[model samples]
Every structure is written in C-alpha cells, then in structure tokens.
Target: MVKGYSNHEEQVFTKIAELRTSNYDSKSINDKIAENQNFSGIIGSLNLTVENYPELKANEEYKRLSENLVIIEDEIALSRKYYNGTIRDYQKFTQMFPNNLLAKLLKSPEFLMFEISENEKENIKI
Candidate 1:
C-alpha cells in the first residue's frame, strides 16, 4: 500500500510539474489532477488493503500513519470547502448590480471550484 501510494504520488507531482512548466493555468492543472485515474486508484487500493488486513491495521506504525492521514485528509476537505465557498461568494459579488459593471469592464476571470469526481465521493474505508 505504501509503495503504491508513493509511486502514484510521485507520478502525480511529476505530471503537475510538467504541466506547470508548459504554462497550464491553475484551474487546468487542478482539473488534470482531479481526473488522474492512477492517483484515485492508488487511494482506493490503499483503503481496501487497510480494510482487508487486520494485522496491518493493528500495527502501531500503521495506526499512527493512518490517523495522521485521516487528519490531513479532513483538513484538506475543509480547506477545499472553504475555498469553494469563497469562490462562490466572489462570483455572486461579481454578478451583483454595481459590481457587475465593474467586473465587465475589468473582464475578470471566473474562479473554478475544487471539485471531486463521483468516485472520489465514496468514503475511504480508513
């Protein structure tokens, strides 16, 4: 599980770096990351392995790492939720009466929400 996760993470980071070097915008880069099947599969596989292996689950190091991962994941989710909320508010503000005229004159770029695919919506076993 660790090997799979590490390899998938490396690949994702490499791809993101490459995309950034190629001048992809942040939203496009984020979309590419969200659509990465290998990364998603690795996460799913790790979750399954943990669920299936009682011994692994019982290991002190594994438990510690798992708890840390859970906390990090929750924090990331919260951050994403907060970011999306801010984007929504900004979009609404831009579309409102006086702000609409200013936005039109400035031609502001639309904010993209950090979205997860349907498969990502499933809870991880851990």
Candidate 2:
C-alpha cells in the first residue's frame, strides 16, 4: 500500500508539473487533477483491504504508515479547501458590479474551483 501510494503521488506530481509546463489553463489542470482514477482506485483498494484484514492494522509499521497517510490526507483536504475558497473569492470579485465591468474590459479569465468528483466522495467498502 505504501509503495502504491508513493507511486501514485509521484505520478500525480509529474502530471501536474507537465501540465504547468504545457501552459494548460486552470480549468484543464483542475479537471485533470480531479480525474485521477488510478490514484483513487489505489486508495479505495487500500481502504478495503485494511477493512477486511483488521489484523494488518495491528502491525506497528502499518499503524505508523496509516497514521502518516491520514495526516497527509488531512493536509491535502485542507489545501483543496483553501484553493476552492480562493477561487470563490476571486470569482466573486470578478463578478461584482464595477469589477465585472473592469474584468470585461480587461478580458480577464475566469478562475476555476478545485472540484472533487462524485466517485471520489464515495466511501470504499469491501
């Protein structure tokens, strides 16, 4: 599970770097991030396996890694929330009366929110 999660994280970081270098728009980048089926699948599988084999949770290393994973997941969730909040603020500012006129005149691009897919929200079960 650790190895799989590590590989998934590496792949995701690589993809994000590639997208940034390719000058993909924010919406495209956000969509790509949200559409990571491979990573999600790995996470779901890990969760299911852990649920099925409760003894594995008793292993010291497994317990340590699981705690770390939970911390990392929490951090990621907080970051996503922050990103979405920033996008919301930007959207509101751009759409306000005077700001809307200015944005139109300047042809400002719309900011895209970091969105989670419905599948991503579903809990994993064996």
Candidate 3:
C-alpha cells in the first residue's frame, strides 16, 4: 500500500506537470483530471486498509500523512468547484447572442464539467 501510494503520488504530480507544459489543451486537461481521480482512488483504498488496522492508523507518521492528504483533498475539491464554475460561465457566454456566432467561427472546443467515475463512487474492496 505504501509503495502504491508513493507511485500514485508521482503519477499525479507528473500528470499535472505535463498538463501545465502542454498548454492545458482539452486532451491534457482531461488526462490530468483522470489521473487526479485515479490517484484519489488509490488513496481511498489505502485508507480503507488502514481503517482495519488500529496500530498503523495510530502511528504518528501515518497520522501526519493522513492530515496532509486531507488538506490536499480539500484543495482539489475547491479547484474542481472553481473549474466547473468557470466552465459554466464560459458555456453561458459561448451559447448566447453574437458571441455564439463568433465562438462557432473560432472553432472553440467545448469543456466538460468534472464528474466522478462509477468506480470512484463504489465502496473499495478490502
């Protein structure tokens, strides 16, 4: 679980870096979003496993890491909220009046709202 946690952490970081360098085009954004969710799922599994072990859960290092993870989770949630809000505003503008015509002419790509996968909504198998 520790190794998987570390591996996933690296993958999430790498994906974010790639997205930034790739100009955050639709494909890059989507990939980073997928990686973010995948990494969250991996952490969920780790937490589930830890829940069944009282000693490990009580460990100082584990507790500290868990606290940090919670902080990151909060930040990610906020980011998703902001991203979706921006998308809503963008869609409203792009779908209205003369702006719609200009948007169509520019071939602007549509952005999708961040959504959870079915697997993410499922209970993790121990």
Candidate 4:
C-alpha cells in the first residue's frame, strides 16, 4: 500500500473519521464541541491556504471547491446558532416561574450556553 504523506494530516483525518463514526449521544457535550472546533479550525486553515494561492483560484476546480467550503462553513455557523438558540429556549422553559416549579419536579437537565474558553476568546478577532 502507498504510505501516507504527513503524520499530522493522518492524525487529523483520523480524528475526523472518529468524529464521523462515533455516536454523538455517547459523548459529553464538551467532547463533541472540542471535535467541532478542531474540525472547523482545520477547514478554516484549508480555506486560508486556498485563498493564498492565486494560481489555485485561477483553476475552475479549485475555485469550485473553495466556494463549496465557504458554503459549508456558513451552514455550520448557522446550524450552531440554531443549536444555541434551542438550548436557550430549553433553559427559558425550565427556568420560568410557573414552569420552573414543574421543571424542578421533573428534574430538568441544565443547559449550557455556547461558550468559548477564555484562551480561545482572546484569539478571536472582531
């Protein structure tokens, strides 16, 4: 068999494969989110790499792939927003006055907001 190129790339891709095969229900939210960040960061780095290559942009295939990646990134961002909104809605339902009493009786699960670690926040621009 032909050997792989970069060990780092292989490891990154392996993590991605694991993410695809693993059951989300079995993972803690933190684990799923860390995977999500790693996936997104890798995709972003690829996009940046493509943008840096004007010769690649000149090729129709590369242009098409870059466009597709951007669309995918946008969709992922939108989906995350929707997911966070859902969590907020659940929190509201469980925390409201009358509903809260019932929620307490039901032992409703606590929901966490979509939050970045302080280190990550420091790296974010605008």
Candidate 5:
C-alpha cells in the first residue's frame, strides 16, 4: 500500500510539473512574439525518450512520476486562475475612463490579460 500511495503521489507531482512546463512554454512563445526573450527552456528539458533514455517511460519510477504529476496539475490550474483573474482586473481598470487618465498621467503600461481559447472557456467549471 505504501508503494502504491507513493507511486500515486509521484504521478500527480509529475503531471503537475508537466503542466507547469507547458504553461511556461506558452508564456515563452507569447513573450517571443511580443519581442521579448524566450525563457521557457530554462525551466526544463525535453527529448525523444526512446533515443535518449531508452524505455525510461516504462520504468516504475517514471510511471509513478507521471501519476503524481496529475495531482500537482490541479494546484497549478488554481494558481493560474488567480493570476489570470488579477491580470484581467488590472487590464479592465486600465481601460476605464478615470483610471485610463490616471494611467496615462503615470505612464503606466497596460497589463496583458491572459487569453483563453473557446475550448478552454467551454471546459471551465464553476
């Protein structure tokens, strides 16, 4: 039972880590497109496992890592929601009339609201 539980935890954590890396990748691409330096590669490394690691995915440790990753992914999603909400609010405030005037006077750059695709919107839960 201990082994099973640990495996599950590892899997969840691994999934969460994967999701984080993916989000970082998305942000990196966005930054690159916005003329900023891409930094996603600094977070993690990737490769073709068959050629590089040779059946690493089939190993028990790797399986446990993958399972644990899923649980971690939920926490990441929550964190992202909080950040997205904050960014959205900042953007909205910057667009308001008096706030817009104040922002202009302060030379404040507008916050970029995070964009979610239609598929993401459709998948959102209350």
Candidate 6:
C-alpha cells in the first residue's frame, strides 16, 4: 500500500514537470508553475512522513522506495525556492523607476509573476 502511494507521487511529480516545460512562457504558465510548486511541496511532505515513520523505515522494501523519495523531495524544495527567487528578481526589475517609464512608453504591461498562494500558506506544510 505504501509503495503504491510512493510510486503515484513520483508519477504525478513527473507529469507536472513535463507539463510545465511544455507550457513554459505562456501567459498562464506563472499560475501553473505556482500550482506545481504546491503539489511538489505536498509530495515532499508525504515522502518525509514515510521516512519518519519507523515501521516503514525498518521494512527493506520501503527503505529502498524511501531513498528515491528523499532525493526527489530535496529537488522539489530547491526548485520551488529557485522559482520564488526568480520571480522576486523579475518583480524588482519591473518596479524600477527607469524601467517603469520605458515599459509604459513601450506598451509593455507588467509581468504577472508567481506569488506563493494563500492555499499554499495555509495547507502546505513544507
């Protein structure tokens, strides 16, 4: 049962990543990426939970499954942090006074950057 859950989590994570790369640069990509981050976080917590539970850890089969989960969890956490940092830089660029003036003249609207969502703040435990 636990093994099945672990596999499903990995599959979902891979699917979300594939969708993200394929849809990259679209107007809606920002929101989608934010959503992906939340899902990734949830997945990480689940993986960590499996690790902290001693019975699961003692089982050799579960231990093998958990090794992959730990690595993937770290990867997801780093990715989310990187995305947030990139968004911060982009937001700062558009807000600069000189850039704002040029952006207005050039008819370039401000980028709708990714923000950590309210649900993420509330439900996400990572």
Candidate No. with top TM-score: 3
Q: Tens digits of per-residue lDDT for model 5 on 12-94? A: 55765655566455465345333211221211222122124446556787668556645654665676578678878887898
- Per-candidate total of colliding backbone pairs: 0, 0, 0, 0, 16, 0
Q: Please write out the lDDT profile of model 4 over residues 1-126, one tens digit for every residue.
A: 113323544665687787788897788776777677777666555444545455655678766876776687578768878879999988888889999999999887775555544543332221
**Model 2: how large is the Cα RMSD against the reference?**
5.7
Candidate 1 colliding pairs: none
Write out the backbone clash pairs for model 2.
Answer: none
Instruction: Report RMSD (Å) for each prediction in the order shown.
Output: 4.9, 5.7, 5.0, 5.2, 10.4, 5.4
**Clashing residue pairs for model 3:** none
Kindly report which residue stretches of model 6 are placed more than 4 angstroms away from their true locations once superposed: 1-27, 41-57, 105-126
Candidate 5, overall lDDT?
A: 0.51
Candidate 6 accuracy as TM-score:
0.51
lDDT (Cα, 0-100) at 22 in candidate 3 = 64
lDDT, model 5, position 85 = 88
Residue-level lDDT tens digits of model 6 in 15-92: 667756764577375566666666656655565566555566578876676677668656756776786787778778
By summed lDDT, which 10 consecutive residues of candidate 1 come out lowest? 29-38
Better of 3 and 4 by lDDT: 3
Q: Per-residue lDDT for 2-121 in model 3, tens only?
A: 565566557656855665576446556667677667667667866676666666666899879888877887788789999999999999999999999999999988876888778665
Which pairs clash in the backbone of model 4? none
TM-score to true structure, per model: 0.64, 0.60, 0.70, 0.65, 0.46, 0.51
Task: Give the whole-model CA lDDT for all candidates, comma-separated.
Answer: 0.70, 0.67, 0.74, 0.65, 0.51, 0.63
Candidates ranked, most accurate by TM-score first: 3, 4, 1, 2, 6, 5
lDDT of 5 at 78: 74
lDDT of 1 by residue, 2-98 (tens): 6654575586567656655654454463464454434445556666756755666777987897788788778868987898898899999999999
Candidate 2 to truth, TM: 0.60
- lDDT, residue 126, model 3: 31
- Residue-level lDDT of model 2, residues 14-45, one tens digit each, is 76566456544544645655544345555655
